[model samples]
Target: MFGYSEEQIAAFGLSFGVGAFILYMLFIIGQLAWESKAGKFGTFVMFLGLAFGMVGYLAKYIIRWYLER
Candidate 1:
Protein backbone atom coordinates (compact mmCIF):
# COMPACT_ATOMS: atom_id res chain seq x y z
CA MET A 1 0.00 0.00 0.00
CA PHE A 2 1.83 3.08 -1.25
CA GLY A 3 -1.26 5.20 -0.59
CA TYR A 4 -2.07 5.80 -4.21
CA SER A 5 -5.58 5.99 -5.72
CA GLU A 6 -6.97 3.26 -7.95
CA GLU A 7 -5.87 4.97 -11.16
CA GLN A 8 -2.40 5.54 -9.78
CA ILE A 9 -2.21 1.91 -8.81
CA ALA A 10 -3.09 0.94 -12.34
CA ALA A 11 -0.33 3.19 -13.56
CA PHE A 12 2.09 1.32 -11.32
CA GLY A 13 0.98 -1.84 -13.05
CA LEU A 14 2.46 -0.51 -16.25
CA SER A 15 5.87 -0.29 -14.59
CA PHE A 16 5.41 -3.74 -13.16
CA GLY A 17 4.80 -5.00 -16.66
CA VAL A 18 8.25 -3.70 -17.61
CA GLY A 19 9.75 -5.33 -14.55
CA ALA A 20 8.14 -8.62 -15.48
CA PHE A 21 9.65 -8.42 -18.92
CA ILE A 22 13.06 -8.11 -17.31
CA LEU A 23 12.45 -11.19 -15.24
CA TYR A 24 11.40 -13.04 -18.36
CA MET A 25 14.64 -12.04 -20.03
CA LEU A 26 16.61 -13.39 -17.10
CA PHE A 27 14.80 -16.68 -17.38
CA ILE A 28 15.66 -16.81 -21.05
CA ILE A 29 19.33 -16.88 -20.03
CA GLY A 30 19.01 -20.57 -19.33
CA GLN A 31 18.07 -21.28 -22.91
CA LEU A 32 20.90 -19.12 -24.16
CA ALA A 33 23.44 -20.76 -21.89
CA TRP A 34 22.40 -24.09 -23.23
CA GLU A 35 22.77 -22.93 -26.81
CA SER A 36 26.21 -21.51 -26.03
CA LYS A 37 27.34 -24.76 -24.49
CA ALA A 38 26.19 -26.42 -27.67
CA GLY A 39 28.66 -24.22 -29.62
CA LYS A 40 26.23 -21.56 -30.77
CA PHE A 41 28.36 -18.50 -30.02
CA GLY A 42 25.98 -16.02 -31.64
CA THR A 43 23.02 -17.25 -29.66
CA PHE A 44 25.14 -17.02 -26.50
CA VAL A 45 25.86 -13.37 -27.06
CA MET A 46 22.19 -12.67 -27.67
CA PHE A 47 21.24 -14.43 -24.49
CA LEU A 48 23.87 -12.57 -22.48
CA GLY A 49 22.46 -9.27 -23.67
CA LEU A 50 19.00 -10.34 -22.62
CA ALA A 51 20.19 -11.47 -19.18
CA PHE A 52 21.98 -8.16 -18.67
CA GLY A 53 18.76 -6.32 -19.40
CA MET A 54 17.07 -8.31 -16.65
CA VAL A 55 19.61 -7.20 -14.05
CA GLY A 56 17.78 -3.96 -13.41
CA TYR A 57 14.56 -5.82 -12.78
CA LEU A 58 16.34 -8.24 -10.47
CA ALA A 59 17.63 -5.25 -8.51
CA LYS A 60 14.11 -3.92 -8.21
CA TYR A 61 12.94 -7.23 -6.84
CA ILE A 62 15.73 -7.17 -4.28
CA ILE A 63 14.73 -3.71 -3.16
CA ARG A 64 11.11 -4.70 -2.80
CA TRP A 65 12.03 -7.73 -0.77
CA TYR A 66 14.09 -5.69 1.64
CA LEU A 67 11.30 -3.13 2.07
CA GLU A 68 8.76 -5.76 3.02
CA ARG A 69 10.63 -6.68 6.18
Candidate 2:
Protein backbone atom coordinates (compact mmCIF):
# COMPACT_ATOMS: atom_id res chain seq x y z
CA MET A 1 0.00 0.00 0.00
CA PHE A 2 1.17 3.52 -0.84
CA GLY A 3 4.17 2.18 -2.69
CA TYR A 4 5.54 0.37 0.36
CA SER A 5 5.88 -3.37 0.70
CA GLU A 6 3.59 -5.27 3.08
CA GLU A 7 6.35 -5.58 5.66
CA GLN A 8 7.09 -1.84 5.52
CA ILE A 9 3.40 -0.97 5.92
CA ALA A 10 3.03 -3.27 8.87
CA ALA A 11 6.16 -1.88 10.48
CA PHE A 12 4.92 1.68 10.09
CA GLY A 13 1.60 0.86 11.69
CA LEU A 14 3.15 -1.01 14.58
CA SER A 15 5.71 1.74 15.17
CA PHE A 16 2.96 4.35 15.41
CA GLY A 17 0.97 2.16 17.76
CA VAL A 18 3.95 1.58 19.99
CA GLY A 19 4.76 5.29 20.06
CA ALA A 20 1.19 6.16 21.11
CA PHE A 21 1.23 3.51 23.83
CA ILE A 22 4.49 4.82 25.24
CA LEU A 23 3.10 8.36 25.34
CA TYR A 24 -0.01 7.15 27.17
CA MET A 25 2.13 5.25 29.67
CA LEU A 26 4.20 8.35 30.36
CA PHE A 27 1.06 10.40 30.91
CA ILE A 28 -0.19 7.85 33.42
CA ILE A 29 3.13 7.90 35.24
CA GLY A 30 3.00 11.69 35.47
CA GLN A 31 -0.53 11.52 36.83
CA LEU A 32 0.54 9.02 39.44
CA ALA A 33 3.41 11.21 40.60
CA TRP A 34 1.13 14.23 40.82
CA GLU A 35 -1.59 12.41 42.76
CA SER A 36 0.98 10.98 45.16
CA LYS A 37 2.48 14.44 45.69
CA ALA A 38 5.85 13.12 44.76
CA GLY A 39 8.27 15.99 44.58
CA LYS A 40 11.00 16.44 41.97
CA PHE A 41 13.14 13.65 43.36
CA GLY A 42 10.23 11.27 43.64
CA THR A 43 8.98 12.08 40.20
CA PHE A 44 12.45 11.49 38.81
CA VAL A 45 12.60 8.17 40.57
CA MET A 46 9.21 7.19 39.24
CA PHE A 47 10.16 7.96 35.67
CA LEU A 48 13.46 6.17 36.05
CA GLY A 49 11.66 3.03 37.15
CA LEU A 50 8.86 3.33 34.62
CA ALA A 51 11.20 3.97 31.71
CA PHE A 52 13.22 0.80 32.22
CA GLY A 53 10.99 -1.13 29.85
CA MET A 54 11.54 1.41 27.10
CA VAL A 55 15.25 1.38 27.76
CA GLY A 56 15.32 -2.39 27.50
CA TYR A 57 13.37 -2.31 24.25
CA LEU A 58 15.82 0.22 22.86
CA ALA A 59 18.76 -1.90 23.94
CA LYS A 60 17.25 -4.92 22.26
CA TYR A 61 16.86 -3.01 19.00
CA ILE A 62 20.42 -1.75 19.19
CA ILE A 63 21.77 -5.21 19.83
CA ARG A 64 19.71 -6.64 16.98
CA TRP A 65 20.92 -3.95 14.60
CA TYR A 66 24.55 -4.64 15.43
CA LEU A 67 24.13 -8.39 15.24
CA GLU A 68 22.26 -8.22 11.97
CA ARG A 69 24.84 -5.94 10.45
Candidate 3:
Protein backbone atom coordinates (compact mmCIF):
# COMPACT_ATOMS: atom_id res chain seq x y z
CA MET A 1 0.00 0.00 0.00
CA PHE A 2 1.10 3.53 -0.85
CA GLY A 3 4.07 2.03 -2.68
CA TYR A 4 5.68 0.81 0.52
CA SER A 5 6.20 -2.79 1.45
CA GLU A 6 4.44 -4.21 4.52
CA GLU A 7 7.70 -4.60 6.39
CA GLN A 8 8.62 -0.97 5.75
CA ILE A 9 5.25 0.23 7.01
CA ALA A 10 5.43 -2.00 10.03
CA ALA A 11 8.92 -0.73 10.87
CA PHE A 12 7.77 2.86 10.59
CA GLY A 13 4.85 2.18 12.90
CA LEU A 14 7.02 0.37 15.42
CA SER A 15 9.58 3.19 15.47
CA PHE A 16 7.67 6.48 15.15
CA GLY A 17 4.22 5.29 16.25
CA VAL A 18 5.33 3.56 19.39
CA GLY A 19 7.79 6.38 20.14
CA ALA A 20 4.94 8.91 19.98
CA PHE A 21 2.82 6.72 22.26
CA ILE A 22 5.62 6.50 24.78
CA LEU A 23 5.95 10.28 24.83
CA TYR A 24 2.20 10.60 25.36
CA MET A 25 2.44 8.17 28.24
CA LEU A 26 5.08 10.36 29.83
CA PHE A 27 2.77 13.33 29.46
CA ILE A 28 -0.03 11.44 31.16
CA ILE A 29 2.22 10.49 34.04
CA GLY A 30 3.29 14.11 34.47
CA GLN A 31 -0.36 15.24 34.39
CA LEU A 32 -1.23 12.71 37.03
CA ALA A 33 1.49 14.00 39.32
CA TRP A 34 0.46 17.61 38.70
CA GLU A 35 -3.23 17.04 39.39
CA SER A 36 -2.45 15.22 42.59
CA LYS A 37 -0.25 18.11 43.76
CA ALA A 38 2.64 15.75 44.18
CA GLY A 39 5.72 17.59 45.37
CA LYS A 40 9.15 17.13 43.84
CA PHE A 41 9.96 13.96 45.73
CA GLY A 42 6.50 12.58 45.21
CA THR A 43 6.66 13.31 41.50
CA PHE A 44 10.04 11.65 41.29
CA VAL A 45 8.77 8.60 43.06
CA MET A 46 5.68 8.45 40.91
CA PHE A 47 7.76 8.59 37.73
CA LEU A 48 10.25 6.07 39.05
CA GLY A 49 7.41 3.71 39.86
CA LEU A 50 5.18 4.27 36.83
CA ALA A 51 7.79 4.75 34.12
CA PHE A 52 9.96 1.80 35.14
CA GLY A 53 8.34 -0.48 32.59
CA MET A 54 8.93 2.01 29.83
CA VAL A 55 12.59 2.15 30.81
CA GLY A 56 12.84 -1.60 30.52
CA TYR A 57 11.14 -1.61 27.14
CA LEU A 58 13.56 0.99 25.83
CA ALA A 59 16.46 -0.94 27.29
CA LYS A 60 15.46 -4.00 25.33
CA TYR A 61 15.92 -2.10 22.08
CA ILE A 62 19.30 -0.87 23.24
CA ILE A 63 20.39 -4.32 24.22
CA ARG A 64 19.34 -5.74 20.85
CA TRP A 65 21.26 -3.07 18.99
CA TYR A 66 24.34 -3.71 21.09
CA LEU A 67 24.18 -7.44 20.59
CA GLU A 68 23.67 -7.15 16.83
CA ARG A 69 26.80 -5.02 16.48
Top model number, lDDT: 3
lDDT by residue for model 2 (1-69), tens: 678999998887777777788888989999999999999999999999997788876687689899999
Predicted structure with the largest TM-score when compared to the true one: 3
lDDT tens digits, residue span 1-69, model 3? 999999999989987898899899999999999999999999999999998988877888899999999
Summed over model 2, clashes come to 0
Per-candidate Cα lDDT values, in order, are 0.71, 0.87, 0.93
Poorest 10 consecutive residues by lDDT, candidate 3: 52-61
Q: What is the lDDT, from 0 to 100, of the residue 37 in candidate 1?
A: 75
Better of 2 and 3 by lDDT: 3
Better of 1 and 2 by TM-score: 2
Among all windows of ten consecutive residues in candidate 2, which has the lowest summed lDDT?
52-61
